[model samples]
Target: MNASFSSSSSSKGMMDHGDQPHVLAVDDNLIDRKIVEKLLKNSACKVTTAENGLRALEYLGLGDDQNNTSNVSGLKVNLIITDYCMPGMTGYELLKKIKESSVMKEVPVVIMSSENIPTRINKCLEEGAKMFMLKPIKQSDVKELRCQLMKYGS
Candidate 1:
């Protein structure tokens, strides 16, 4: 599936340079992606969406060309919120790939899953994911997410 991205400008008026957090949210499910987009928008973040891990890598400019490292200096994705279970590349794999990359490693990654398996959550955390969130993310979650973004910066 083709990767897609959307930026929320509704809260642009309320933000200064440091207020807007650029986020890359990945999910194969359209509804889930939209939910993330909406939630982040509500929190006044600049959000982008990707259909899967490979597409997300492409969005970050990390495709098949290993030599062409993801140049995120220009895009400045502060946080990556991705669904843990995807068709091709799971969120764990995506987190590993990002952590392995010199250009993208500094950008914090968060994994979201419907399953409440402790091992899965622990594994993601061990693999460098900042947080493992439960599926159907709520508005309350956005508050903590915003705090994380602030700590990480844009």
Candidate 2:
């Protein structure tokens, strides 16, 4: 699978929110990924995207290299928003990986899904997810997202 990475720098008409929060959004669906990228950018966030959990890990500088804290672009990721269900890795699994890693543990992670399974939500939260959002995320959700980023963006 070809994983595409996009950032606010590559887009047109994106506002320059100076020193804005940087977010990494991961999802398998193209439409869903685009929606996340657009919404975060609209909210004045510097957004980046990956098509899967593994690609997201790569972007987070957690690949074969031992220095997982160093991102490829050298951008400090403030928060991570990921889809709950995906082909290779579930959001819960991704959350666990992030929380386990010493370098990436401080970064906040949020999970999104169309399914509102209480068990799934609880599992994600237990695994260190900062928040769980329902699918078709709206503009109203951006406020909470901003809050999470601010709380952990340091």
Candidate 2: list runs displaced more than 4 Å.
Answer: 1-3, 10-18, 67-69
Model 2: per-residue lDDT, tens digit, 57-100? 88888866775567887778889999999998888888898898
Report clash pairs, candidate 1: none
What is each predicted model's overall lDDT from 0 to 1?
A: 0.84, 0.85
Question: What would the C-alpha RMSD of candidate 1 be, to one decimal place?
Answer: 2.6
- In candidate 1, what are the lDDT values of residues 1-154, reduced to their tens digit? 6425554556435344355788899999999999989998899877778889988998787878777665433557889999999999999999999998888898999999999999999999999998889988999998898888778755
Candidate 2 colliding pairs:
none
Q: Estimate the overall C-alpha local distance difference test score of candidate 1.
A: 0.84
Query: What does candidate 2 score in Cα RMSD to the true structure?
Result: 2.5
Model 2 whole-model lDDT (C-alpha atoms):
0.85
What C-alpha RMSD separates each model from the true structure? 2.6, 2.5
